[model samples]
Target chain A: MMCYIYDGSFEGLLTAIYETYYRKEHPNKILSITDYEKSFLYKDVFIDTDPNKSDKVYNSIKTKISNQTLKHVFHAFVSENEDSGTWIYNYLRLGWKVGKKLDLHLTDDRVLAIHNITRKVSREIHYMQGLLRFRKIKNDVFYAPFEPQFNIVGLLASHFANRMSDQNWIIHDVKRDIGVLYNQEEWVITNINLKGDITFAEDEEFYQKLWKEYFKNIAIKNRINPKLQKSNMPMKYWKYLIEKN
Target chain B: MEILDKLKILADAAKYDVSCSSSGSSRKNKKGGLGNSHISGICHSWSDDGRCISLLKILFTNYCIYDCAYCVNRSSNDIPRAMFSPEEMVNLTVNFYRRNYIEGLFLSSAIYKSPSYTMELLLKTVKTLREKNFNGYIHLKAIPGADLNIMREAGKHVDRMSVNIELPSNNGLKLLAPQKSKEHIIKPMGLISSKIVENVSERKLYKNSDKFVPAGQSTQLIVGATPDKDLNILTLSESLYERFNLKRVYYSAYVPVSKHPNLPQISTPPLLREHRLYQADWLLRFYGFKSQELLDSKNPNFDIHFDPKCNWAIRNLHLFPVEINRADYEMLLRIPGIGIKSAKKIISARRVGPINYDNLKKIGAVLKRAKYFITCQGKYYGETKFNEDNIKNSLLANSSDKLNITQGEQLSLFSLYPNLLPLPDILTKITGEL
Candidate 1:
């Protein structure tokens, strides 16, 4: 049995994948770099964090697989699947041997598992786009806070930035303590500290009033099924929705 | 009054209008326009029932002079009613747009004071949003009996407009809703259609002419309320699309709220029936299935166990085992598991090389479902029996055990006794060929 340790980052994982392919050693087990101490009497190899090796692997992936495939691999990594480390090792080994036709073996169980995880993460990212309802604060900046099931805050930035290009808005991933700030033309992801009280301008309140009215007015009393409504727009998300209040 | 109170009342009233789609238009941002509508569309929110809330669907007023029995906002109902000023609605839309909370407005209204008066308020709201706020992508509801001038003015300002053909038949309307007449609804729809055609032709000659309801028109029909079968409903919807140049035809399942002697006392909403109708509707629009082909006098409803397409394939077993290589695009679309995308893929891939079963999976065909109906080259892998009854029984047996167990239970009696079943059940018996 052989244990390989990689630096705890996406690039580090890519470098590890590169080493596994180059070494050509069919290791019985693969472990994260942080789990080095946990390796029990196995042949352990500690990989030095190499940016050049990571870049080479990324380039090879970009050339061999489509850009979409590289993105799927990255998303699979973010999914934090329990068996992903081993699966990534095998996937890369298979891709290196296949040479630019990796998707041909997508029906293989191991490849399909990775693809499924990646698809789930992608779906979560889309769901959050529709679910993330923002409120306007005093400075014409829109503010929204959410605690999504997955680390999808980074994925949602481009969607909002493109859709709400003319307006200034901030979508805060409250749990992760990071947000996407869009001002007129450009948008950037930044760390935010929102522990203190937040306030909106009088005009913001005026608009909120109108939105609240709109939300209330849209529900048909004849079809007022709170049970059904709770299923779609959960009570957990109501705190941030303007109408829920 | 404060805008919040008005929002509550209007949102509640407008919530019943089950046509919240903001798609089928590709309007771009003009030099000074605040927003634009994408053809693929954007859904701003998904409501509790897992339905997408695209536009800010709200009514201008819940105070109605016409007392439709099925409506909560009927004049007879003792509920608190409210109306939004044109200025208030425009402000709400602008503010909401700035906050990234909505795609656009889905402005609808009750018959407040008079049909003309209600139409005027709706027109003013869209006008304010377009002219004063410079907002774009508005979908206004044309009042059924409103003045043609008001409807025309509405068409000029908004992206899309709809006049609900609430009940399928005039008799259904007479029994359930007394005040609304078939002519009142159909006449305005006809006027809007002609005006849209005129605008398109005029724009061809004069390139700078203003667009009129560029998203086109859509209408909704309430299902399960009247005695109309799925055949009747689908036939009418087919005519509406063919004649009106409609962008979409939405179907809302009737949820009985009133304890009227006329209505049925049902426990759950007819969601499955509504879903089947929508599936049938899609078949009519995208797939080459006609309404008459889907249902006839002998069998006038969709199969509850399987989707309309799957049911159709099972019934017509003689048509099955179509060779994927030789099958035309339309024929490929008729296969149970092959959607438009998959059919196109098969067509494209076959041009390059002969495709087998493995290659079909690569193109995203649901092999489990398609396996029964399709052939690769000359080899047919479906059941050896190859009879309609055997194929249907096997398909139903396999499908009933899967996700649609409850639906199977609801439809079991109909599948057994087609003629003796109720109208709803009879409709569920005939499979639509989408």
Candidate 2:
């Protein structure tokens, strides 16, 4: 049995997928660089990142399958699904057979798995866009910190850029140790490490206090259903919510 | 009083207005502007009732001249009242919006000095927000009997506007809210609709000059408030949709906020009935189901046990067991478990190949309900036979699976003598859908 190992990056995974199809060698398992543990039972294949090869495979998919299918693949890769590498490989192979209508093959297990993963990633992005609370940090910058289940910093930055064009903001992904900084013009994703001790603006807590007050006052006393609230907003996201606090 | 104290009083007073959706306009951010509206609106928070807090929904002031029987802020009720100065209101809206706490403002006001007085104040607040280039979505309520000219000017600055028809019929309005008449409420609705139509055609003729009520108008009807039946309310709503070209008609379950001799003695709101009405409203808007198709004058209320769609499908069983693989989109949408999303998915998914139960579940259909109404290639896997009573029992069994498995007190009851059942069970059945 052979296990395929690649650098833990979306581009590297796509390149590894290209190699599997190019060499026609199917591996028993696919693991990211950090995911693989030292084991002697299976032969290991290390895949190097090659933009040329990745672009070739990407172009083939764009030409053969519809662009919508390719977009779904990218979103699925950003998801935290551990089996997403092999799943993408199987999905692409199926896409090659089914052409642009590959998404309609919902009965197939591999296709359905990819579809669910993409949906999950997009849903997470949408939820974070709404649920995230930004505070006025120093330098007059609006700073918000979150721990999303997917790598959605870029998506959130693009959305805020469209919505708040004249403001400077930074959305940090605490789990990924990366953040997107938008300086009232453009946004760039950078590796960011933060010190826990940080001070907010002088009137920041006042606005937050008002917000918490508004949140509490708006709820109807008779219609309090904590169960339904939990269903709409999972408890995992409560840590960053100022109102919940 | 301080703004903080006023916020608490105003927010508490505004809780009964249930038009919470912010999904209408898709106004883009102007250059150097501070905000924009997404095509699909955003919800900044959720209240305890699992309802969205999209906009900073609050009344500008609770002081009113009319003593509406159902209003908590009626003149005779003696509730704590405060008013926000136009400056204070503008500051609050901008600060909250910049903090990402709300999409925009849903500013509603009571008749302070006069309808025209309230209208001018509303116009002042929204104009200030727009002059500051706050391009966020604004849904301002139009005060009935306001000058048509001022209301139309107000429409040009905001994204969406609404004139709530608080009651279904003219008699109900006259009895509960004496100052408000059906003509007074609908006049602004007709004005807004005509201006929206004019803007559409004007934009088509010329290039562009700022639009008027670009998201169109919507109204709210208080359910369970009067003796008016669902048939009357729905037919009224259908006509509003046809005549006014309204964007939406919100149904707010009547929560008894004030005491009056005419009001019901019940303590809690009829949330399930409201849910059924919303479901029926969705059928009217998206499924192309007419109000007459869902309910008739003879049967003025929806069934308590099943949703409007399920009840319709159960009565019209000859239309089904529709072949899942071959059903048209409209026919597929008529099934109980197949929503717009699932019906569209079924159509696209079947273009690739045939689908069965497993695929149906993955494609987001509620198979527990759909199985009784649909078949995959003419094969039915439902446990019960093709009888209405049996299917109803099976559906109930699915809902109360644990109760049935534990041999709990049987819930089976024939409608032949529905009035004879115990009062507790009858109440439970009425609120069962929730």
Candidate 3:
């Protein structure tokens, strides 16, 4: 029984799949090098970082499966879930043998498990699209800061680009330290550092005052249930909500 | 007056309206307007109380002249009163919209000074938002007993209008809220509907006339408050829809705020009952179930355990075992657990070939409940008995256990047989259903 180890990147995982295909050696276990200390007691085979092998595997999977399927697998990898790496390895192996019809047999436990993680990530992306509260900055760029449970910064780009087509917007995911910038015409995802005091628009104080006023007015004193409200909008997410602060 | 202080007082008063939905309108920003509206309106955030906060729902004032018993803001209640000027409301709306804090405004108010004066103030707020600030997508509440001319002027600027038929029956209104009458509420709705129709007709001829209340109107009916049953409530709602051409009818479960001898002392609001009524209401609008078909004089109340559609289908077993391929759209809607989406899917899929059990699942049918109602071609996949009595007993037994879990009660034999054992005896034994 041989355990295959690769670099923690998604491309490195694809390269390991290339080796599994070429060598025809079924791996007993598949893991990332980050989990090396927790490696199982089995014969180990480390695949050296090879760009050509990674490209070949990426191209093969792209051609065999639809772009939508490849995107799901990529999202599952970036989610960094507990069993994500092994599930991707197993899903691809079965997918390659069965061809494009693998998604139809979702009753299989391994396939269903991967599908569940991808769905969670997708749902978070949809929720953030609706829940993202943007604060207007001086440069006329609308800025919003969020801390989503999953790394969904990439998924939110199209939503803002389509909805706020005529305006500039930036959604910064504070948890992952990444941001998606939409400059009216296009959008790009990049790393951002919010370490120091970040300055907002000059009109920030005025808007904040108005928003706080509106928030205070909307609550019905007759039915003030702090417990019920806390259940819907948890206290953990209140730091970013302007009204809550 | 300070706008901040007034907002706090007025918004706190307006929070109990429970109709904060900003959906059902597709208004866009005109040349000078600051914002656009989507047909499927946005819910900017969910409030802590699990309600949608799509709009900044608030009143212009909480000071009232009429003494309505059920209202917290009645003249007799010793609460602080406040009002916002039109300019203050417009500024707040524009600022909130720019910050992505709210989609639009849901402006309601208690009748301050007089009905005409309060309606004029509400109208001034919306008119300033549209004409002065170029704000888009305002949902204004029509003050009952307000002048017809004021309501007509309001229809021109706002996207939607609602005059809540608060109580179901005239007697209920007289008993709970003496100041309000049936005609006062229903008249404004009738006037608005006719004005909407007239405006639409004029637009068809002129090609550029401004839209009048493009989102139409809706009303709210408080559930479980008065002696009216589900049948009576639904019958009234049906007339409100057919006669007034209402876009929606919202049901708010009664939450007792004040200690009144007449009102029931419920520990928690009847949220589950509200949910079931919404399901039944959806059936009325999209599923083609009339009020008579859903409830009757014998069983006037909805089943507490199962949803209304499921309960209705189980009681009429003769209608069941419908062949998927041959069932018409209307008949397909009658089957339990087959929603509008699944019924449409069945129609479209069966056009190519005969549908089977596997095909039904693919079309998103809830087979756990639909199993008793439908058949794949000729083969019935449900339980063999198909008798109403047997099916009802089995369904109740299965559902009572699930209800116990949801109500945070332990599963006991006595709870499993609610009809046979007295509720007090069961409560003493298990201490559940508190």
DockQ of each: 0.23, 0.60, 0.22
User: What lDDT does each candidate get?
Assistant: 0.74, 0.83, 0.75
| Tens digits of lDDT, candidate 3, B30-108 | 4333666657666666554546577788888888888766677878889988888888888887777766787788999
- How well does candidate 2 reproduce the true complex, by DockQ? 0.60
Which of 1 and 2 is ahead in DockQ?
A: 2
lDDT of 1 by residue, B1-434 (tens): 76677777778777768776666666666443466665656655545344556788888888888877677787888988888889888888887876656778888888888999999988888887777635446888889888898898889888889999999999989988899999999998998899989999999999888888888898998877766888999999999989998878888777766777766555445766787898888899999899988888887887766888887887786787899989999999999989997898777666646888876886689887788888897887766477777667767666532343344444654443332122231122111011
The root-mean-square deviation over C-alpha atoms between each candidate and the true structure, in angstroms, is 5.7, 4.1, 7.5
Clashing residue pairs for model 2: none
lDDT of 2 by residue, B364-418 (tens): 9988899999888779977789888899889987863222121223134212212
Provide TM-scores for the models.
0.79, 0.94, 0.75
Which segments of candidate 3 are over 4 A away from where they belong? A1-126, A136-141, A148-168, A175-195, A200-239, A243-245, B30-33, B132-136, B259-268, B324-326, B345-364, B377-384, B400-434
How well does each candidate reproduce the native contacts, as fnat?
0.33, 0.62, 0.38
Top DockQ prediction, candidate number:
2
Q: Which one is best on lDDT?
A: 2
Give lDDT: candidate 2, residue A164: 76
Give stretches of model 2 more than 4 Å off: A39-41, B400-434
Q: Sort the predicted structures by DockQ, highest score first.
A: 2, 1, 3
